[model samples]
Target: MDAATLLARLATVIDAHDWAGLPDLLHRDFTCRLVHTGEVFDRDGWVRLNADYPGFQRMHVEGLVADGDHGALRARVIGTSETGAELEFAVASFATVRDGLLAELVEVWADVGQDAPAGTRPQLT
Candidate 1:
């Protein structure tokens, strides 16, 4: 598969929580690292992390770019935490594709901050 095709299919797998289908798209030695958390995971570990995420969530892809053997994705996730608090975050990931499959992924993510209240902005002259 081409870079774009691989990324789109990967998103599909994630949204569907289709763990079994992951191996078809991920290389045997695939690895992923979360930059903010300083954590690195192998293919199985990465799958397990998502599979075990704390609550119901949806990942929305906002943008994607692919060139040659690399791709990047920008996304937002909205979810309700186990504690019943609403949560939102943004994520960006860079991926390496080889042999028509994803060989590596490095991600950076952040909790989406709330805007100031309606009246917070200062009046301008």
Candidate 2:
């Protein structure tokens, strides 16, 4: 599969919260960086984190760019917590693919304010 196709599949798997499907897309030693928290996670760790936040409702892939064996995707995620409170975030992910599997993923994400539009620019004071 091409990088774009793999990325789309990854998004689909994540949207479905199908933890079992993740291994098919990731390398056995896959590494991920959470840009906001500056934390690094291995494949197993990634699955564990998602298990804790299983309420993701919607994910929109806004853009994708590829160069050689590397690519990036921008996505908007909207969801409600287990308690029913709404939440939204924008995520930019950089990935490296080798032989059609995702070997690494570095993602930066931020919480979007409830009153803000999906891609609105933040106001600075």
Candidate 3:
């Protein structure tokens, strides 16, 4: 599959909680880096991490851009805790495709709706 199509499908499978379909879009040597945590995982490890994430409900792709074999995407992940509180995170990912499969991915995640740091910028008019 082309890079864009593969990435689009990636989000779909994850949102659907179809763990079995994830590996099909990954290369044999696939690697994923969690930029915020400084952790890295291979295909199996990455899949396991996502599958085991606590309270994971669904993932929604907010935006995507692709060029050649490289693509970048921003997605929102939502979950509900045991206490019934909703949580949301914004995840930004950069991915490289090799031989029509995802070879490498680097992701940075942050909580959504965080306020800007004090004095970082003036309020909008």
Clash totals in order: 0, 0, 0
lDDT of 3 by residue, 19-109 (tens): 9889999999999999999999999999999899889999999999999899998999999888989999999889999999999999999
CA lDDT of each candidate? 0.87, 0.85, 0.93
- Candidate order (TM-score): 3, 1, 2
Query: Which runs in model 3 stand beyond 4 Å of their true positions?
Result: 123-125
lDDT of 1 by residue, 10-74 (tens): 87788777878877888899999999989999989988888888874678889999997899988
Cand. 3 Cα-lDDT: 0.93
46-69 per-residue lDDT for model 2 (tens digits): 877875676678778999988767
lDDT of 2: 0.85
Best by TM-score: 3
Q: Which candidate wins on lDDT?
A: 3
Q: Give candidates' CA RMSD values in order.
A: 3.2, 4.4, 1.4
Q: How many collisions between residues are there in candidate 2?
A: 0
TM-score of 2: 0.83
